[model samples]
Target: MKLAFPALSVALAALAGAHALRIESSEVAPPADIRGEHQELERVWSVFSAEPLEKLHLAVPGPVFVRYDSSLRPVVTPEAAPTRGSAAGSQDDDESVEVSAGSAAGAVKEAGSLGSEVKEAGSLGSDAKEAGSLDEAAQEAGSFEAGSFESDLLANVTSHSRRLRAHKKTQDDDKEDDESDAPEVLVARVVVTGNSSELLNMLELLALKKSSNNGLRFHLQNADATAEGFLLTQVQLAEQHVLRHLTTSLSSVVDVAPRVLVTNSSETKVKLAVQGASGLLVNEPEAITLRDLDVEISGSGFVQLNVSSVQLDGKLNVNLAGSGAIALHTPSINASEIKSSISGAGALVVEAENLTATEIVTAVYGVGVGSLRATTRGAAHKQKITIAGAGNVYAGSVVANRTKVEIWGSGEAYVQVKEKLDVSTAFSGNVFYVGDAPEDVRTSGYFFWRTPVQPAAEDKYETHAAIASPAVYPEHVSVQTKQARHSVDPIVKKISVGAQSVVLSSHLAAVAHGPNALLVFGCVAFGLVAVGMFAQSFQQRRARRHYRPLV
Candidate 1:
């Protein structure tokens, strides 16, 4: 029984060795490839974390093997199988065969033992399969979760959002800067290309909104006296698209009303009307009207119609009509011709070098025409009328009736009278007898003649009065006469004579010579009588006069 026990022990030992070898060859060798595949799968999972699975598909060889290292368990290596021996002796051999059979049975039993291990390994494999299925499910779920997480992270990490936020901040800063940099609305400049009605309407609107103390004000360009304080109606303001402003250029045109209306503060509103080939109209308040009011007319072939007030710092060729007074201050009126009746309470001063008035009737304290003329009728009913021209006539009349006329010239003044006309001069003139006048009447400077007959011969001439120097004529003289129910008075005095001679005589008296000769003869006779009496008295008085009263 002791010997049998030893043999069974040896047999059991041999069976254990063979089982280990089988396990080592079958299970342990496969696990090496499995572990390596697991590492590769782990690397793939990391790659999927960054890039999409589809993108990694092209880089990887095949479907990646993923193995879960649950609990990080270590793999076991199976032991090698034991070797068999050859024996001799028939009986011994038979016994050895029995022993071997017993050993085989033992081996079978050992192999049976391996069945449990195999079953355990199969169970482990099943577990590994289940774990792999679970891992796949988790991986699938992780795909969605990772994708969602990546989307969320990307949304937050994107540069677009940051850039948008920065842009919004920049816009806010720009808005603040604009608000801070904006200037105050103290003055408003409006430019109008057309009429003044729109400007007037705008003014009315402004007036309605403005404070009573802060009234609207404006300045009219080249406004006449009659155009001051002109009133404008709403209708007029609407039809004209005139611009209104605080201040405007003077080169532009302004159409103002005949009267100017203002608020209680008496803030004058000025309107400007440009009347030229190319013109503009502007109406502005006086407060801000001091800026550049230069209105420039541009473009060729432009026509500007009737304008109320035009301040011309530029060229102008258009008609102007103002119901009010027109003030021309350094204004240039250039046109084919200018014809307008100017009437103003204020004086009219024309400082223009060239002015031609067809009919000028000025009623002012003073009127100055500098190289100007009234080609037609010019009446100056002012207190003083001064004509500085070399040829100027105060009156013109053609009739036998007597009329008072005053003419002044540095040259000669010719006066022709058809009827009995008396003329006096502080000068001298040549005399020629056309009618029946005696030689004495023709040769005298101061003489009285009535139907005097001219002598047939030139030698029968007589002298009335002669100057001592002859070269210098009297400076002060007068001529007056009353004949046939007529009285005449001279108007002009201190007449000057040049190299030309002048004649003076009444037409009726110049026809006869008896009256003039008789006056001269009577003066001579009286002179002789007085001289004889004076001589006789001197002689008698020397002989001692007696009682002359008794004789």
Candidate 2:
């Protein structure tokens, strides 16, 4: 009875092993047809592979979202290598290249002989050009004597220009057609959800699999049973560094638009260097290091920017082309010295309602408009504001101690001065201020408009007009503000991907298979019988040892 129980257990264990092999062999690999539109990743992985992936590079031709989450565990699968047949084929190719080396050397010698012949031909052509010049001189003398030289010269010039234009037109058309025929790489949206340690590992993986050819696809998602996270491939960076500098821009060729969001969840201070994409929204960080803030606006190119608590230590450059609008909102600004140069059809709004600065220097060029709503408390606080284009500087709400204003174009400056005000106006440029005009006023072709009474609260500064143009805005800009007003938080959906296969506990299906299954069962039975016989012989020896020892 004891032997029978042992045999039964061994048979059952073999059947269970076969059943697991069937389950693993039957599941399908993940699909590759992931779209460019944004999709959120599932938070958890139910049955994950134990393969540890260090890093991931996503090279999909679309926007990618990378966020930090502490709840997820690290689960990855190692990439499968190519088969032995492909490796053998590569070796054969190397041998064939070595065999062709002798033939390639012979071709090189023939090319050298051809180059010597071409040099001889070039010398003969130069001699023929000299003879042709002598004939042309004789022809020119004859035409001068015939008194129709000017008319003939004009006709030749006209014909030559027509031929050049036709050739240029053909070349332009060919260039356009070549550009049109080029393939458009599909933009893929990839979201990576992991903590800082896993994120660093992903960076390492991208470094290993870097290549010029865009053939391979890499994904960074928790390994789920259904494999819903992997949709597109990733790109590689040269080296690992702190995730500080980031650029978000729309591709001229790819149809997918660019959108970026950077939010600091930890209490630690973070620095950001942003290449201002149109729809960029950044939350307020404690200490920020921003340099060369450049935005190019063309066509319907409009950008809405809101950054708070700025300490001006770096350069801020804003350029506008084709009537594109930019509304920059800064709530508080602290600067030791401020210098601003605005040109083109750009508009700038510095909402420095609580601005503390010792010196503010501003120069406006082109039809650029600027509005500064600042309050300077100290007596040493001074402003040097200059306008050269048809632009306007509406600083009527700026209460400065001493102000210097210069206008060269049809520009205007509205100021609120405390003690001394210096104004210089040329052409139609004018300075409109409340309070008596100080003695240091110079006007060359225009007159100053000084209001007798202080302006009303509503009429302190002119309202901006660029904000109303093409109001289709970014989601982050709208969502953040709306939620703040209503005191309502946004809801996040937690999705768990379910397993696609049936869970089978019974091993009968594995054991009922053909000859291989029966053979495995027979082996298990034989092993159990051998172990039982060994145990029976050991018991008989022990019984004899106990009786003989007593005698």
Candidate 3:
């Protein structure tokens, strides 16, 4: 029993050392461009923005796609009124009033000039006026009274002139309001034919400005001042079964409604951001570079991104809070570092080279599964994974130099190690690895066990990076499996050889708590006692057979 104590403690310490790894600088910088820069493209834009006519012409170097923007409602214009004649009559009335006002102003000016001349003459002849009779002075006084009447008339003329100007301004303002109330006419219909392309080619030579890539992209939006807010109806096409080589096909709908259609000229890559329950399909035969992008999916939204190689700015963030699905597969991802977390029922599958992350978390609230196929070049590029709930991470295909893992619940992690693996487990959580065992380990748990087994068969859906695509999982299916079986391939693999007979077969230990721990220790003690008794009985039988009665 004392010997068993030393053996048990040594085994627990080894299990602790088996699981040990860490990641540095786990923060990912936010993307700078979500909805790419907006710029107008020449020639192609006229087809969407020009006034509706019976005929329309357009051309492009590549294939063209046209779609109606359902988010934009038709603009309803008010009926034209019979206000042309009334406006003309008001202008005529204003002109007549102006003429009469001008005549009254001229009479007032002439009367003022005569009054000034008389005052100057009266002042000049002061000596003569003294010699003159009082009668002459009385005549001059009468002329002064006449000048006062002219001054009052001038005031009345000025008042009349001001009234006429106010009336004219009021008429002009009413005319302007009438015109403004009239609605504007936007593109209502378009017709594209073979000749349209020829016309576009000719226009490009004549008026088109030299652009970087000259690649054109069309945008359909609302004609109202506020271009965003309404929901866009998306029509999904049939799924393609072709693998490795995939293509995107889009259909268009045309309607006689007022909408704004703008065009953008792309130079290198397209920056895209998708929100709500939207589906995004990205298929590029050549390498694709992305910077500053964000995507959020709710409900049944999904994203299928396949590229040859991808270059990230500084950070890439993807959140699947609902049952949404995301499949990001690429040959290589170039970046300083990356991090990811899954907290919903959704599934995320990723495959790339040298995939380093601070920690891949499967939160307590999460019921999803994550599959990662990555390779680290050096020990400094080690990865970390944490399983806190029922969420599982199948990283058996990942060949890492070092990995650090933590299991806080019943969740399990399958990893492939090249150098070292550090683990800490609580509750019923377990850690499984297939590679060289660690030389030293320590654990805080009471009981620990390690088993060796031959590698399981490869999964049919397994690729270089993922066990299976998220698409394979049916909608609303439970992420948890009934039992760990190799038949599923993705979740668990069956071991062959003599190691297969073991109930718990792996390279690491299983941590049990409370009653479970007591039960396991009791079984181990009983097995040891039974073996000791059997050996003693065999020895006594041999001794009796070798010596005769007393011997």
Candidate 4:
């Protein structure tokens, strides 16, 4: 009975060892299809393979939500490699390339007959298909009404593009149809029971993989938190579709940011949280509606994010906190508005042609710089800019229909406003106004003419400042007390002797096994200040013009 139990236990353990976490595919509607209008990522996998990953690159051709979670392992079974004898083509077998997962080319081979299959992709049938597709596109290009020429032309162009893509896919398949076929990779989503699962040795094999229909997606769980993040290459999407809910959070310990290229998507909104030192670059978007983008970094994590919008149906709200920089190129259109806030020492730069916001509120808690460059002739609505911060805000060319600027704090709001202006400054903050100032600019304790009065067109100071002549500092230094009339040598020697003695005593204490002797530092500092005053006095005495008294 004992022997039987041990045998049974061994068998069960073997069975458990054979199965681990299973990979599955959910019912995700992929982005625009090849024949449809979307391309999306709809699957995840922990494949089987014993190779190491050199690089990890996933390119999803649509808006993809990436996260890490447990449970729901989709079961999959890998297929055996197909033999060379399985080739059904009549062509010389020497030309057959064994296409495999490692190869960049692959296609599903369809059998034409039971005894023999059509595998000669370079044969006359493929040529006929290509010729037929071209003929159809050409026919589509011509069959259109005279009045609907532009619409028909667009349709024909899209048709031709699809055909060309299909043809290219065919050609790519032919290039690797005969390569030494590696092991066949096959996996289907299946229901599994129990919590235990096994992972395949597909580390390097899965790296830089291009997932079809699902585009390309990879998730990192708690088990993979220590592992390095991945990069995404080309994932192209069509118009009317936008890359949505794309959130990337980088570790503060990581030195490199994930490189992503998103362009021409109708409404692309990206939120990137860089915890450490990393940089991200977002080139252009057709119409971006960024909402509550919070980039909070603790360490010296520098993030460079550039977003451009041509149209907007939503507001742009960005909240930044950390030690880095974030800049934006807002839309030139007047319908959009932006709301931004900054904390911790992070720099923000905005370049826009028309910044006609309904209620623009910008605040900086820490010592960061917020700058805005606006260049527009006119705006329809009354633009209101409310700025409050302890940091500097340099807003250039606040030219609009009716501008209202309100500011407070120790920060400076350098602005140039046009039309009717309603200005308010408080808490000793400066409102350096250019162009014509409104009559009702309420001020308290804050300085309006804090800067020089000379103003230029468009509220910019264009002229260069002239250098001041010498002999400008004699009033303070020339007025010496009668007690000091004895000589400059005694006081100079006293200050130098005190400074040297303190420094020597501090060094001796440090040598005598003291823990950071900072006692003598104050004396040295005072002596240095006195020496600086004496030096300045000497320079002023030399620089002062000697006026001969009329005898």
Candidate 5:
């Protein structure tokens, strides 16, 4: 029985050893769902597995779930357990249970309990599947995470705050740049409309950089102002603070029809130079210095200057009823001229070098140091003309009228009278004075002398009437003796007693005489002789009678 027992025990031991628990062709069936949620398991396997899980695709399927220990380690199953009452139990039962317990404890140390491992493996597999699905969806949607998972989540709140800070920083940079690049405009045009006062105020604002009050200052850098197409009723400028550096240039034509006053109080003085087509209607005084000023005035007004002077390098056309004067140092009417054709009571004084006039009427009066020439074509009945100068006087003709014509000069004066000349002057030259005196016309002077020219008898009444009038003689007259002289010709009948004696040569004759004594003496002598003859005849008769008979 011992021999039999030993052999049988050996056989039983061999059988039990051969049937020990072991994994036989372990195969992991894949779970039905595999996605990003299962990626943790994959990562765990990557950590635990010696080789890539993909290489073990044939082995690991579903979720790598299989009969496992607490550590999720693959559990090897025994081929067969010892029968309950078999001789192997009594021989190896304790060893087999002890081995199993050791294996269980090792698995617990590595992976935890079996239930917990199963749960974790399943969750990891699910998470991996979800991650895969999300990746696929992101690819399909054409989107990407800006950062990694943790980074993407944190960027939401933090990125907005970062962006806001960056935006503020950019704004600060822009402001810094703006401080260096401020914009500015060089020149601009402006139009102003209002009354004269308003217009003047605007001009003062632009030119002087202030309003009516000179105390205020403007912020503008350069003050240059101009005006056009403005109608002013009455405008005046402040006399104190007119800007001297202001410049105005016309872009178009302008017309100003009001009283304009321009004054200056600055030490440098203000100047206004105008060009283009412009007209001014000045009812008051306008003081300015003109360089190339072309001004036209159509109203009856005057332009008075209170400053140094006014110069015209251009033309001025004025039609005025009042008088206007120009104050100049060396006043000259240069090549640039002025035309003043005013008819109604007006006077123009040009204190210049020279003045020229075409025609002047009777109501016009002018005074100048230059030359004055006048021509008269119409008849004047009783005209009193006076011309006093060191210059010469020239006239065309003088008719027979009660006209007083006086020409006085320290120089030589040549006078030609076509009609009767009644002279009263101290003339120096041997005047070739020729003219017929009518019966009522006479010539008288201080030294009265005339060439002995025979009087024409055909005008006897005119000659006699002229001689009979004592008031019609020239005062200072000295006649030349070489010429033919005649006195009391047959054509001259009557003679006056107190008439001035006139010497007549043989070429000249006197036919009339006053009463003399020679003729009276001859008449008395003849009468006395006739009376003596009568007495002698009477005495002879008496003697004869006495001798014969007493008679």
Candidate 6:
């Protein structure tokens, strides 16, 4: 909704109190104009200032989204006070912005120009010459008819006149005007209105400028203030679904934790990134690539990253709860690391070429919650995915050369590998191998299963096992199953077979040299029989010599 500056009653007391509102080197411009500059200023602003208005506030009870806009920033103004509206004009060179208030408004402090006060003080100091005449009158009267006591009084009067004259010179030495010390302050208000749902989302965009009312005013200060420094001081949210998309790039130093925030991204152009929890959603034609963003998304708001190009770099943290999910749809992802904590029943899914992380470390503690991806490019050097609780990971056609897949708790994990896959599962979850299964070497609770197409190998090796609790013993339960690839074509036919033996003729000739081997075996057999008879005779003699009876 288009909003206008409303008729707001400024607390005249605040502006005029002991600490008068003071603003220096800044002007109050139309706030609608500020929104247009947010996208244009991707670099540091040499000047800093603020714009304020009591415009319409959007109160949304749903979710809020922030995204970048390539379109021209619209220049709009809010409705002013009903009586006279607002008077907006600029100085002769258009370097100055001026706003005039109508009814129910307090006064605006203008730049100071001392007029009568300095002249009045100067006139008082000039009166010292008139006081000198009193000293002459006193001397004349005392000399003519006064007694000895009157002469002493005339001397005291002359001394008092000289001292009063010195006061004027002292005042002139320190003649700086007092009015120049205080800076001029611009007083204005920001008004927000909408349903609580809309306002919740809109509140994330609000920014305010705070200063001491008595501080000296600054002049020609750059008015490039950003909304990044906005503090989320007060937020009252109801149970409502609010969704919004906003993109902002600003340089603001945060003094307090903002109710909503996007932090400083120095020097590099942020291609596009979704560094939050819940979910990320974007479906632009020239999709924004995510890079160098750290966002933690909570609540039930889901974000989708459906951009044309996106990168996840730096340290990214994702937290999801309830029923919302964080989804990625076909985006180039290059991340240093992605750390996630999942609770409740939220799911994380990356479809097709939708997921890529150099190092992914995730923990899932909720029921049926997990991180699953169907396919990913093998651009990363190494990829690691770890799931805990009742969660698991599935890699349908991922092509990462160096990857590690791990699972914990009562959930199962099945992953397809192109190069190498090291898996470790604990508790009741079954570990299924997709392409190259592990060698049959038993450590503890893990068993290997071969694909159904390789049935002979599955039978040759132990395909399954009954987990044993040696403590409880002889009662055994059988466990074994054959896994088949999903939706595979059943038709197959042999193409060709070679009739020629592939072995080298030289190796066969080496065996031909052993023709005398049978003759050697016959001689060896005859020699063994003679040796056996001699041993038997010696054994009979030794038995007779050492014979004894048990009785």
How does each model score on lDDT? 0.24, 0.39, 0.37, 0.38, 0.26, 0.34
| CA deviation > 4 Å runs, candidate 5 | 1-301, 306-311, 321-335, 353-551
Error of 3 at 497 (Å): 53
* Candidate 2 local lDDT, 342-410, one digit each (tens): 555556566645666677676666576777665432222788887765777777766677888877656
Model 5, TM vs. native? 0.17
Local accuracy of candidate 5 as per-residue lDDT tens digits, 1-91: 0133443444344322221222111122232344222111111111121111110000000101111122322333554332333411333
Count: clashes, candidate 5: 50
- Misplaced by over 4 Å in model 2 are 1-246, 251-277, 285-305, 313-322, 375-380, 435-551
Cα lDDT, model 6, residue 74: 28
Residue 517 lDDT in candidate 2: 20
Give one digit per residue, the lDDT tens place, for model 4 in 36-109: 11112222343321111112222111112222122322243444334455643434553465545322222221
For this target, which candidate reaches the highest lDDT against the unseen true structure?
A: 2
Locate the minimum summed-lDDT window of 10 residues in model 1. Answer: 52-61
Q: Give per-residue CA lDDT, model 6, range 181-211, as digits (tens).
A: 2222232222222212211121322222343
Model 1 regions more than 4 Å off: 1-249, 252-384, 389-551
Reference-based TM-score of each model: 0.15, 0.37, 0.35, 0.38, 0.17, 0.37
